[model samples]
Target: MRLINLKPSRTNQLILALLPFLALLLAYALGSTARLAENPSDKLLPALSSIADAVNRLAFVPDPRTGEYLLWSDTLASLGRLCSALGISTLIALVFGMVVGMFPYARALLAPFFAAVSMVPPLALLPILFIVMGLGETSKITLIVIGVAPIMIRDLALKVMELPREQTVKAETLGGNSWQIALRVVLPQILPRLLTCLRLQLGPAWLFLIAAEAISADSGLGYRIFLVRRYLSMDVIFPYVIWITLLAVLTNVLIDLVRIRVFPWSELDKAS
Candidate 1:
């Protein structure tokens, strides 16, 4: 069979999906063993046992000073900022995307501006945000919004513009006004794409959030990682990084599920 036509069975697919992760774990274990054998005081590539201990301390044990589980607290703080910023970004994208996609004059005025804005690196604006908004949750959340919103806006706008022109014409033929057509037609068609855009932006959104948190924040996964780095706490840092990855993966999965549940027709559209 040609490579293009070859497909794995479900069991083979599952095994293939797991192979890379298993290899990664095995490599880390071997590296850690070798490093520790050479130098028992090695701080890098900590053994899995040490990582487990750190996870227990961070996730299960409460801090002596703060009396709160560090991992859970950090997760909450990071997620609060992430969700708030993404929510704001989604609203902004939906409104502006629709306006730009549906109205030529609005598109002429705003599309180029947003397209340029999206090109600017979000991290470069971190200092400005901190100086202007101050080193608070607001600045962190704003950084994430600034990083992800413009791209999302552009993506959603393109999706809206790509929608079949015939749908709008049919709506107009039914005597639907501009507002009616937008409300009944454009919004529904672009919502699935909106979710997809949000999904695509999640990684950048997390990057911006972590950058902001590392630079200025009292509590967050990023802050904790940076705080511990002074002492070369690889065990803690490693688990925190893994925890962040797991969270992002969970979020991506949840978003896909919600999209499938809410917009089953989008899947059918894709199949066709």
Candidate 2:
């Protein structure tokens, strides 16, 4: 039973492609077991079946009435907010990270601040941002940016510092001045790792999204989650989870697709 020896192949890839769906199935199985443990007389299996059925129903094209079903507008709205926030944070992270990371003194001065702020919890910023920026889209975007950028800065800075010294030296020797070496040579080498960090930040982005939307709005998956919690409805909970899970999967796939496009070398290396 040497699972570690199992190398990935086309079959593995296809199976792994279904892995997220498989996980949902497994979650359902475990949920039923937990329900049975809690109550011997409870109809756990039937409840699980109903939840699965409701998931399919709600997934259909929701009608014009807002609360009639899980409207696609809400999903798009949530995703749009995420994109705005994540986009700004990514750019800020890349620029500030590369610039400050290249300089030892800057890293010393700023890295501690970045690390400290990250520990404060992005939810703590929600009230202030909501007041200052209001319950507007700006507040939501800022929430995600605050949550995501610190980790980005930390990872990006570390990766930049970890880059091979020979690249820097060679650039300098080739008449590439300070700015030229960092912008032209160093950045290209580090962009792949930066992309990886951005991908990793998506989970935190979701957390911040909840914080942002929990305050105001009738729509979005996070708000829907809250609505279900009010009634203690596990069936309703499943739909929101499915929505988020699908979105996360799609976002990661899109990012990876773009990553492969931008750096085809990574794919080549993987194949080799």
Candidate 3:
């Protein structure tokens, strides 16, 4: 009966998770109905049917100019940029974070710089990125890297630093050199933490990608949303926004599955 031990059944848990989303839909429906009753031409909060139609059109119909479905094209473009940036960032974070965390000299040299870089506002660097990298996919991907890399690096370095000193000492005592210890002892422990950091970085990564796309890209969810804003097409915009949210959620879920499958020990540690 205690609150700490209370556990809801799976059915109840699913309902609890969905309750807020249902409430949100109901509220929006009521609001849209009220607005339409007053002014049948209201576009600010379009009816559910209007939004559904817009989604169907964008997702199903091919664009006349590009001969590709806008929704899928934008999703593909954005996902490519996102995955590339994140892959580069992860490699950079893993290398630099391990070096910084393991070596005192490196830690002293790079930790402060990373801390300062993470503090800089990523959006403010959009102009610099475009100017330096040009208005292309490189710039868009670089924006995401710059936005999320520093923080991810810092998180990973801290995770590595938190590894017990006794383990490193034992590895050394067992004839393991720094390289051997790092690869065999440290890397395995840190991999799960790295995935967790990447999952956490998804939000900021999406923000930077969207900002870059909005400002310059020819195709992306953000570009599409901004392109339609001049016409005040809330239906299209709302559905696009929802789709983006779903994409982010799906990415997080995938990372969780990877962690569960690849590092089940990490989950066991957490549960204990």
Q: Among these predicted structures, which one has the highest TM-score?
A: 1
Model 1 pairs whose backbones collide? none
Model with the higher TM-score, candidate 1 or 2: 1
Q: List the residue pairs that clash in candidate 2.
A: none
Model 2 lDDT-worst window of ten = 40-49
Rank list by TM-score: 1, 3, 2
The total of clashing pairs for model 1 equals: 0
- CA-lDDT, candidates in order: 0.94, 0.80, 0.94
Write down the lDDT that model 3 would get: 0.94
Query: Which stretches of model 3 miss by more than 4 angstroms?
Result: 1-7
Stretches > 4 Å off in candidate 2: 1-64, 67-69, 267-272
Cα-based lDDT at residue 75, candidate 1 = 94
Candidate 2 C-alpha error for residue 204, in Å: 0.8
lDDT for model 1, on a 0 to 1 scale?
Answer: 0.94
Q: Tell me the tens digit of each residue's lDDT in model 1 across 66-118.
A: 99999999999999999999999999999999999999999999999999999
Local error of candidate 1 at residue 121 (angstroms):
1.3
lDDT of 2: 0.80
